[model samples]
Target: MITIWGRLNSHNVKKVAWAAIEMGIEHRRIDMGGAFGFTDDYLAMNPNRLIPTIEDDSVPGGFSLWESNAILRYLADAHAPHLRPEAPAERAQGDKWMDWQFTFAEAQRTAFQGIVRQGKDVNDPQVSASIAATIKLAERFDAALGQTPFLAGKAFGIADIPMGVYAYTFFTLPFERPSLPNMEDWYAGLTARPGYASQVMIPLS
Candidate 1:
């Protein structure tokens, strides 16, 4: 059996859960983080005190793992090997998009947190910064999509999961977002994926 910890609304949790759906990995979930209280047992599992820790009793090396991307990569490396890559060149392409999400997509949302999540107005300087950064990144996103139907190209893969989860916040979050056709098209395509709708496209907190 596999157990996943964290709120379904959490972006990080969505990554692992969505990946599991993509890979057809059966798992259960525990409500934790946010309004749900953390427990001593969870701490014992992941001292970093983060949501989205995973426990797969059947995996060879261990029962649990933390860090959502690592969990996604691990699952991809295991059951959905085609979703990831064994060769260096293909792996490098995947890494590029993952790195871009961490560096570009994640950073562009800082103001979004300071504004919307904290209940502050969009005009707040931090909010403005977030929008500005997002506008710039939206162009980048458009360019990326222009080249590939998916981030790592053609078919959906591990490289698409992390940022794909993050992308939801941008579109659903209450705020004005500049129009970028490429990003919107890419998101629409992701929305059509079986696992994405089931596991990733849920109501936000």
Candidate 2:
């Protein structure tokens, strides 16, 4: 069985856990990190000491993987081929959005940390600036969704996973957001999936 180590509330852990469920892969998730506290045992598996590390004993040599996106790509390539496009060119489209989500998260750190973490009010200048920046990127995502039903094309793939996690946080926050029909529609579809609803659509901490 695949063993996953991370707290459920973590966005990164949700990516791996969500993919495993979607692929119908049996996994044992050991809660660690956050308030659970990291141990030396966990450190050996991932020197970086991050959440969402996976130990795949099914592999020939036994494998440990880190980085949420890397784990998603690995799970898709190994167990769920449908989650990734078959052709290289087609797969690159999914890769593009996956990478873009990382960039998006970094860009959103200011706002996320301020509003979500620090519990800043709307009047705070830092919160205001961060919100503006985040909305600007959301507009870009909306424009992209207008052209394709999914980030990777017509079908849902790994590309949609990360953003789906973030969308929950974005929409849940008490902020005035501009209406983006296409993005909202795509998110609605994601919410309809049991895997997404159980994993990605959880209450953000």
The lDDT for every candidate, in the order shown, is 0.80, 0.86
In candidate 2, position 192 carries an lDDT of 91
TM-score of 1: 0.90
Over the stretch 72-91, how does candidate 1's per-residue lDDT look in tens digits? 88888777899986678767
Index of the highest-lDDT prediction = 2
The lDDT, on a scale of 0 to 1, for candidate 2 is: 0.86
Per-residue accuracy of model 2 over 1-205 as CA lDDT, tens digit each: 7999999988888888888888899999999998998899899988887898999988999999899999999989898889898888778887898888876777677777777689888668987877788889999999999999988888999888988888877777778999989889988888899988888777667
Residue runs of model 1 more than 4 Å from their true location after superposition: 60-62
